[model samples]
Target: MDGHHHTAHSVFPKVSTTGKKGKDQKSAKSAKKPRKAEVNYLPPYPTGENEESQEQERIQLLTEAPTNPNSNLTRDVVIRCLIVYLEESLDHVLKRYDDADEDSVSQDLTVQRMKIYSIKTNTSDCPDDVGIVVEGMKVLAALGNFPRACSMLLGLTYAVNVANPKELRYTFEVFQKFLLELDCSKLSPKVNSLKNKTASLGKWALAK
Candidate 1:
């Protein structure tokens, strides 16, 4: 009985040593394991540096606009040397006065305005063309040639359903309101929309 008890006690020490060796092996393996690297997630957006570069590109485009024909800032000066030539050419019905009548003065002014209209009807295909045409007509009116200005516009209308020049909304206020008091419903949708806005704004601004 004594020998059996001694043998059982000796077996327990060997089992405990095996468990300690396993624990030491597990600790060493844990120390050898590599740590995962932390990842950095960022939002996709334009930073300050990107924004500055974009701004610089925009400014470069603006600086190179002088030679650009499509630029709105392009200067379109009238030919100064031809001014005198045009003015002197306004002599109509001077060779014979017998053919003149009460309408001669009005008719003569109309002829002069037509001369100006000939120059204004250049029909610039540029986006700023409408502004140029409108400015010329306004100048004609200012120069006491309103009839000729009206005549030039009427001449354009003869075309079958011609489109309003670039920026139809702007052309509406400048040309249609300045010269013709035509029915608004007949104009382009853009022009009609602009007129609606103007009417609404006018009504809004009006005091009760």
Candidate 2:
């Protein structure tokens, strides 16, 4: 009987439920360790090649306009797309004519700016802000493209009707700042006249 009892006890080894519970608890705790979260982000500034590709994509989107006459191609959407195209065109101009004269370099830029203004003119409801145009002028002036800068500034001023006093003042301030930084000797008589015309417009607003 003793031998049978020993055999039975041995066959059914005493396993503590507490031990099993502890093991499970350990596994659960281990499984709950925090991991670093992964995130994907877009680049702030695209490379030259990326700019070209993106511009082409935007053009393709323009061409593939919905056939339906009732399609919603909003002015804001078109303007945004055109702005992107202008940026891309500027990049292209900079890249392509790295060694060209200012006149030659400004050709493409002039065309693009005119095109943007033309679109803005057509969409009278969408008021043109001179911010982007001012920025382009600043860049051209910095690059010693003074004549082109002057021409662009004058043309843009005429094209964009800044009825908003705040916007007009701000645009003139930016333009005047650009003029101040220009090499006076490089500026033509026409440029000087243009500068004189806008002389009364100044008093920069505090930056937001």
TM-score of each: 0.22, 0.17
List the lowest-lDDT window of 10 residues for candidate 1.
Answer: 36-45
Question: Model 2, range 82-151, lDDT digits (tens) per residue?
Answer: 3253232323212223334556644545544322221122334432222223323322222122222333
Clashes of each: 0, 0
Please state the error at residue 52 of candidate 2 in Å: 3.5
- Candidate 2 regions with alpha-carbon error over 4 angstroms: 1-49, 66-208
**What does candidate 2 score on TM?**
0.17
Each prediction's Cα lDDT score? 0.33, 0.34
- Residue-level error in angstroms, candidate 2, position 157: 10
TM-score of 1: 0.22
Candidate 1: the clashing residue pairs are: none
Q: How accurate is candidate 1 locally (lDDT)?
A: 0.33
Off by over 4 Å in 1: 1-152, 155-183
